[model samples]
Target: MMNNKKPEVWLRGELPGISTLLQPAAHALLQSKEEVFKYTEGFPEFLLWKRPAGRASVGFHLQHITGVLDRMLTYAEEQQLSEKQFEYLRNEGAEIPEIKIDHLTQAFTEKVAQAIDIFKNTAEEKLTQKRTVGRKQLPSSLIGLYFHAAEHSQRHIGQMLVTISVLRNQNN
Candidate 1:
C-alpha cells in the first residue's frame, strides 16, 4: 500500500475541509507520513544515530520533522514558540539510548495528525494573511508556513530514507 507506484497525492482530488490551495500541502504531509512509516519499518535501533558519510542521522530527521511541523504551525497561528518547544528544538538529535526508531516515527505520526486537525479549522480566506515567524519576525503567509511544513517534512523523510539506505548497505 505504501508503494510509489500509486498516483501523486495532489491528484487525489479535494480533501474535505482543507482550503483548495492548501490541499496539496495536506496531501503531501499525509503521504510523507505513510512513506516514513513504511521506510522506517524494522529499522535497527543501534543505527538510529549513525551519521553516515557526515550526513545527519535518521534520528535527527525523525525528530526534526515533528519539531519543525509544530513550530511552523505555531507560526501560522501567529504565536511564538513556547519554552518547552524551544527546548525540544534545541535537543533534536541528542543520542538517547531509549529513543528507538519506532518511538520517533510514532511521534511524527501524531504530529501529522495534529497538523491535519489544525488544517481543518483554518479558514480558506486566511491563506493569504501575513504571519510573523520566529524571533526575527520574518514575514510569511499562513499558506506559506503550512506549505513549508509539508515540504520540509517530506524533505526530512527523504534524508531519512537515504540514511537508512546507507546504514543498511554498510551492514551488509
Candidate 2:
C-alpha cells in the first residue's frame, strides 16, 4: 500500500493570497470542505435527513455549515444578513424532497471557496475592526467572525461525521 495522503491544509504551507493572520481560519475552512466531501462520499440519500438519538441529521449539518459560513463572512464584512440569507438560516435542517448528498456537499464546497476569496480581499488592518453579529448586534471583531466561521464549520463537520457513521451502522 502506498499510504499516500496529503497533510491537512495548514501543514501544506501558506495559501498564496490569504494573509498570515487569516491563514488558520482559511486552513480550517478548507479542511472542513475536504472532510465533508470525503466522509459524505457515496452516502445514501435516504439517510441524508435521518437523525439518530434526536441529534441533527447529516443534511442539517451540511446546510448549517454552509449557511453559517455565509452569515459569518457577511458579518465579518460589517454587514447585516440579507433577506435571502435570513431565509436560508431559517431553513437550515429542514428536509427537502429529492435532495441528494452531493447537492449539499457541493453547496458547502462553493461556500468555502467564497469564504477564501473574502479572506484574500480582507486587509490585515480590517481584522481588528469592530463588527456585529445577528440582529442582536452583539459585538465582535472582524477576525473573530472569520475565525468563528472556520471553527463552527469544523464543529459541524465532526457532528456530521458521527451522524453519518451511526446512520450507516444502523442501516447495516
Candidate 3:
C-alpha cells in the first residue's frame, strides 16, 4: 500500500519568513517537535524516567531538547543565559514525579516555535557573526548556534526513541 503520511518538514517546502540559509535548521526543529509528539503518544509517565541499559531516559531527552534549544538561541542573540535558564539546565533529566510526558512534549513544541520565530527574524547577513557559548566562551557564529540547536535536538530525539522503544518492550 502507498504511504499515506505527509512528507517530512524539509520536504514540505520553505517556511515563510525563514531565510534560505536557515531553512534546514528550521525544518529540523519542526521535524523534531513532530517526532516527539508522535513517539510519546500514550507513553506512560512512569516510564519517562526509566533508563534502560543505562542510556539517558526519555524524560532527559525531552527536557534537554527544550533546554538546549533555548540556550543555543540565547547565544545566537549574543546574550548570557538567564539564571532561570541555568537552573533549568541543571535540573534537566531529574526524576521529578510531578512532571508528565505531555508537559515535556509541550515545552519542546513551544521551544521549537520560539526558535523558528528567532530564525525568521534573523538577518541573513548576520549568520556569520561571531558568538560565544557557555562559561568558557567557546567561539561560534550565529549560523553555527542555530544549526547546533537543530542537529542536537535530532540527536536527542533519536536517543529518546530508542529509550522509549526499550522501555515499552520491557513493559510489554
Candidate of highest lDDT = 3
Report RMSD for candidate 2. 0.9
Clashes in candidate 1: how many? 0
Q: Estimate each model's TM-score.
A: 0.93, 0.97, 0.97
Q: How many residue pairs clash in all the candidates, one count each?
A: 0, 0, 0
Worst 10 residues of 1 by lDDT: 1-10
Better of 2 and 3 by lDDT: 3
- TM-score of model 3 vs. true structure: 0.97
List lDDT for all candidates, in order.
0.90, 0.92, 0.93
Model 2: residue 93 alpha-carbon error in angstroms: 0.8
Candidate 1: C-alpha lDDT? 0.90
RMSD of each: 2.3, 0.9, 0.9
- Compared with the true structure, what per-residue lDDT tens digits does model 1 show for residues 1-172? 6776776667778888877787888998998998887888888888999899999998999999999999998998899999999999999998988888888888988989999888899888989999989999999999999999999998888888999998999998
Residue-by-residue lDDT tens digits, candidate 3, 22-134: 99999999999999999999998889998998888999999999999999988988899999998999999899999999899899889998899888899999999999998
lDDT of 2 by residue, 46-106 (tens): 8998989999999999999999998998887778989999899888889996777888889
